[model samples]
Target chain A: MNTTLTERILGGDVRSAGRLMRWVDDDLPEARHELAALYPHTGRAYLVGVTGNPGSGKSTLVNALVAHLRASGKTVGVVAVDPTSPFSGGAILGDRVRMQQHSLDRGVFIRSVATRGNLGGISRSTPAMVQVLDAMGFDVVIIETVGVGQDEVDIVRLADTNIVVTVPGLGDDVQAEKAGLMEIADIFVINKSDQTGADRLLRELRTMLHLRPRDAATEWTPPVLKTIAVRDEGIDTLLTNIEAHTSWLSAHGARHQRDRTRAQQFVRLIVTEALSHRLNHALASSDWQSTLDALLARTQNPHDAADALLNAILEPR
Target chain B: MSQEPKPRTYRVLIGKPGLDGHDRGAKVIARALRDAGFEVIYSGLHQTPEMLVRIALQEDVDCIGLSILSGAHNTLMPEIVRLLEAEGAGDIFVFGGGIIPENDIGPLKEAGVRAIFTPGTPTTEVIEYLREACANRYQ
Candidate 1:
């Protein structure tokens, strides 16, 4: 059954993926090993990361993109990352209910991952999940974010193409400028074009685009396409722009870009892993939890005490 | 006389159709189902017609509870129902519940949806309906 699970996943079996996701969440060590073996089968799918502020119509835009891709005869996989509430530590994947049209399509797959305090805009398991999607041989993978914070921007580094969706009337343009959003957009989508100020925002976006030397230019520079995703208006142009970007990246040594991104992903993971190990073995090995009580009681200096714990770990065995 | 203290359990597949990202209802329903003792295999969001059918086949699930809030139900669900029939999963029961309106209900039911749960329908009602459906299917 276990081997079958892996095989079915490779075969793009939906039940298999659902079971595997749970296995991942449960931290089954074997599941990790099995997935590692499946990694090479990935790198086939074109990963497109879509990010923007919360309520920027990212889900709606993604829905349109998926529809376009399906119409063009491509299988798609989507990863929607939502923030886990700090107080409850539970995933609020409410976003999944928004794009429910593909429920019956065999060629599309979507999974929601919780950003469990992961700083760079995803849960630790996200990149791996994307790899799983890629291995499943999806023609395209769309990653929709919880929002476009600094962490959200970081998701761009993992994708071959990054689309930053912007809406009008939310001061999103100014926020985008302040957040350095323009730096990462491969294609900028002005959604809700029916609303006024979208054209103004598009002009501002173009003006911002003009000021910079192209980050990675090819046959096509990043284009700003206007869309009313709710009405499914203007999605084809946006999708065409996305295709343009991907082919451009492929011709421009997407391999090197992927390596660069993958290296950073691993580095982040390793550093977090090492630090966590240090906390678990080096610091928590001591009577640290109670020591904080003493510090709270003014009997010890937390700074010195923290240093002592680190020093103990540094001493080794 | 009825038997005392019956063991209540239900099985459901919580599925998503197109690209709608409003899964708040699905997640809440999944939790409610789990608490209600139904083993749920949630297919998450953005599932294509084929993927959902594939899942429904393998899980051998009794019920497929689709959560469609995207307003694309007309374009999506009929295709799924057709696919399910083609795949010989025609015996499996299918229903939908979400932000659908009164006007859309008759068409959905006409398309062979067992029942449609709209907003304000309690989770208990869903559980009870499933329990009855599963029993009827088994019988």
Candidate 2:
């Protein structure tokens, strides 16, 4: 795709938007250039990450949330990360089967990504992809992780407001609480609230929240909103809670703090890229296979070997 | 232990486009392709069509597959083909699979999408198709 098409995508061209994401996914050489061109327009969108365990009804919740945002005339972009099979590296039919209902809405764009051992249970390139959406002027970007527990928690690091979802029938909410998902959530959604045991789960969640230690200095308490998302019941309340959290973050300057955290992540990406570049250029010239063999054989520590590689990068031929 | 020789590497790029964040099939297909001895570069979910085409050009892959369960395939797939023309990836074979309606399959293929693998497509079909398509494309 040319710069014109990339620009057209930022100008709200649907076709261009689709193409831009592909470039990022494929890690095309043009990925950086295309994203950089669109970077100036980003930082305007509100990024929200919705995550929870599988069967927590997060997709339905997200659907309701998208409808809420679109009704308010916001352009919404959704990134759903599906779990990859351990052996096949292929996606299971989860998110794709979940939200094919909104195919006609022009304001909503949903892209499903497969997570193939992206260590940390999140897509390694997710943050950059979010920046692409933000840059494209999506008023709201909701990133939904593959609701597979802790691995899905990486959404919190990439999102501005991470919403942790839970449901009634899933045993104890404490498992979620103990996982510290409760700690990262700006808004906790109890979906499928119309179910019989909904109230019990809510009570358990509240009880855990009570017992959990708070960040002594901060007065902001994350709200727990119950919803029957499929019916769209209480979604407005969830939206209201989200708005409240966003307003609170802005008012308390916590949004900036989150931005600084995101900035560090970008820094980490750059450092990783530079290190890889240096290493591959230098060590790739060495017997990379033998070197790896030596390391695996416990003859050399990775750090020392890395130092040796870095030295090679600096050393003249 | 007698190690099996690595199969001849065939690289494919699979992408999801435009606001459809459902990627289960894409991941599965990518993984299956990898295990079948093809080197795969997967763009983690939610890429646009323009992004996919550009990546196909850059990675110099043998094939490009897309999973679009969002039903925007009509609007998005054509755009991918158009961009592929610009990037000179017109020769790169493109295929898609997902919640595609049976009727839309005809149009998708007419737009030059080589194949449309819907839900329930056996992974073996994909591996076999790629082996054939890549051989022919290269030849």
Candidate 3:
């Protein structure tokens, strides 16, 4: 009567899933094995990425979105990412404060992760955690990244629907021309739209979208919507637009393409990590130390030393 | 490939349970724990025992640190431990802080709370106790 953790997760065990998520964050080998077994059950849940600047109400907006989704009878999971301290390596994950209303709901699972040292808006183990949630049969998995402005486009590669949230007074319209967040957004949200500059921001966004070069007849135009997330205003419209994007993705065969890309990226990252681990192990050996000594003595040049090291590790002994 | 596995980064939930609206003490402790390299999930103010236990279970944290100042620690602290035990998560360590009377500490600990730090206790003491306590529990 021994049931595996993977089996328990598939049987709707929240405790098991929560433990696996912790294992994933700790980089435990058992977690990898369980994830390999659980991979086949994934891809059934829709992944939504929500990213915005600090103080932009991303968590509030996510709370509203989750409430709306629950009203429609869908199970939800959230992976909220917060930044770890570069000096102390600790993090205060306070996103759950905004999301306390859903804490008692069995159908909702929320997990917080620290970025550790990852440069992207997400943690290194985010995709794996998403897989755990997906396998656990959540209808929708929402990823709320650490507050990011521009140049954090990694969410585009993982999420089926990438939503870039901006507020009215952040000068986002001009910053959008800088080319990172603007290009990665599948949809744009102007939260806190009751503020003074809401209309100006909206007009600037529309003009920018209009000026962009695209095949308007066939391409999917990213819609710019407005919302006051604290009052839960416009969340229903936002959810409808998200669903519209989901359907458009399936109808245009983009979902399959995205799935393939995600798979390829995941496999490549695994290989890279394994190779990096092996290289670090090799570099700690006496032979590599001798090489380092020779390089310090200037008898072996830097390029030659690197070549020898790579050859020693990559070649089958 | 026989290297030792990395230590688990113990996560602690700093919850302000019951009707206590003043959370400055909780926030200070949360920041101190973060500086000591423990991931701290702050539940903000006005949380019930049900909500705190639910968050602790979902986060899979190693410890629950309840901060209360409204003199309801006797009722609220034990209720959290009971709810956590009911959910089969009794192994998760529970601790408390804030204005608890010296008389109530023994009963709270008897009810499965491992430790309690009263007001004016140094933040480093809490961090050190957690490190030792959690290491023993997990090992």
**TM-score for each candidate, following the candidate numbering:** 0.68, 0.71, 0.96
Which model, 1 or 3, shows the larger DockQ? 3
For candidate 3, lDDT tens digit of each residue in B14-125? 9999997999999999999999999999998889999998888788888899999999999999999999889888888899999999999999999989999998899999
Q: Point out the higher-scoring one by TM-score: 2 or 3.
A: 3
> Model 3: runs farther than 4 Å from truth?
A315-317, B1-7
What i-RMS does each candidate reach, in Å?
Answer: 7.9, 9.4, 1.5
Question: Model 1 over residues A166-187: C-alpha lDDT tens digits?
Answer: 7888775567777867777788
Off by over 4 Å in 1: A2-4, A148-151, A213-221, A287-317, B1-139
lDDT of each: 0.74, 0.74, 0.90
**Candidate 1 local Cα displacement, residue A194, angstroms:** 0.8
Q: What's model 2's lDDT at B13?
A: 78
Q: Which DockQ-derived CAPRI band holds candidate 2?
A: incorrect
Span of 10 residues, lowest total lDDT, candidate 2 chain B: B1-10
TM value for model 3: 0.96
Clashes (backbone N, CA, C under 3 Å), per candidate, total 35, 35, 0
Docking class of 1: incorrect
Write model 2 residue lDDT over B32-139, tens digit each, in one string: 886775556566566767656654543446678888888799988878887777765587778888889999989888998899888888999988988898777645
Candidate 2, RMSD to the unseen true structure: 8.3
